[model samples]
Target: MLFLNELLDELQSGDYFLLYVLVSAIAISVIFAIIGTIVSMNKLVFIAGGVSHASFGGVGIGFLLAYHFGWKNFIDYSGPIYSALVFAMFVATVIYFLTRHQKRYSDAVIGAMWALGMAIGVICIERVPGLKISIESYLFGSILYVNSLDTIILCILAVILSILFFVFYKTILSMSYDEEFASIRGIPVNLLYFITLQFISIAIVLSINFIGIILVIALLTMAPYIMERFLHSMKQIVMGAIVLNLIFCICGLAIAYQFDMNTGPCIVVFAAIIFFISISAQKVLKKA
Candidate 1:
């Protein structure tokens, strides 16, 4: 009763923004988790990793251009962030199309792009002076400071992506399982693959502000992989990943609030714990 009263008081006092932030974080997590699962199921985790890393270059380029032009009025800092997302997606699509023929060397291509992106970001950041924000936050994530605008954008993207995923569920699953078969069956394999790549890019960018680029891949891939070990269907896997994501988001945010820890790393730590627990449970069940 006392706890309820305090909660009510917090809600009445606008402390509910914390709850909003928590929900938004979970939603963002869910989006990445779904994208990660999609890519992983299609045997494209490395490609996704490459795209995520390459996005740093996009960020650097965006920042460099905006900073040099003194384009604060025209391009908000976050605008470059979106532009970087577009650039990264474009690069991913090109890489995907180029490597579609030389399937064996896909990883090598991804690795080269990843390194180049990082180098570009480094040079861009070094050239800039008196930039108040830490680029590291974008690389790793700083979830606790998420504003309402970020939350809104995340929610909107998640909804749109979810709808698209649902409508094209069969095409996506078909492409994942056997692209050649999908193509033979007239599934528009190339178009579907391109769409998936673009969506993955957007998902990665959306996640950057929450988990940082370094750990974002883990949050995206790990939750779905762990869930897939137990869940049979793709639907179950996605749902389980979303639930697990929500659990981590809430627990991480609460702990961060209570202890004054950084939000992004804290959420990843919580997710790691959950992964361990799930693994242990699976082992115990197998033994029993």
Candidate 2:
């Protein structure tokens, strides 16, 4: 009806950026859900969390370089961003390799690295001058600002990540379920671990512009974790995660539009509410 007509009119009037932002948010949520499920199954949540937060360093470096080279345009900035992501992925891999053998203090090491990465990002941003963009948006994502390019990049990354996941699904499942057994059966467990960490790093980098570094970890881990409780299998978990993510995105967008709120925080808050309800329901059912 009338609402539908108005929606169509908005689309025709080039005010569809909100829709694009929702799409990008869903893309990010799906990517993180996949990564979160994989890492959770493997009991490597801390490491993945580390990689997620550490990606801010990549953003800082990219922004600094882009500003220095007078490349404020999107196309010119893409290269440095990708290069910084490559560096972040390398750092994540090295951290993984270094801490993989440690038994008691691995989380501590990863936490230290995460803090160091954020510190470096802050320092880099402070050193850079004449940058007009708000660093907070990059650190804590303002999804309302996502443009067509961001949406396209998100879709492309999702497709590529999906293909990679499908090709190695069984092997990765095996490794996550039982790495020692997977290694015994010649499953290349170490290589799989490294690739998973790299994938997580890349996803985090891509999501920095939508969810911010501080809140990205929640979007990456919480939605999937909540859905996993209700789903009986990995496939079902993924499906449920996507559905929940879409719901949150739509509701968040509507709320942001109605209340003049920040989109990223609104989305995260919606996710938190959903998570709380899920957990409470589970508790009630268990009591019953």
Best-fitting candidate, scored by lDDT: 1
Q: For model 2, how does the per-residue alpha-carbon lDDT over 1-288 read when each residue is reduced to its tens digit?
A: 332354578788978865676678678767877787786677767776777677667767777777677766732334445755876797787787788777577877888878877787778878787667777776677764677887898888888877777798778778877889899999988788887888888887777767776777777777678977877677667667777777776776667666766667877899999899999999999999
Q: What is the TM-score of each candidate against the true structure?
A: 0.91, 0.89
TM-score of model 2 (CA atoms)? 0.89
Backbone clashes per model, in order? 5, 0
Q: What would you estimate as the lDDT of candidate 1?
A: 0.78
Residue 68 in candidate 2 has what lDDT?
74
Per-residue CA lDDT of model 1 for 191-214, tens digit only, reads 777778888888888778777777
Give Cα distance to truth, residue 122, candidate 2, Å: 1.4
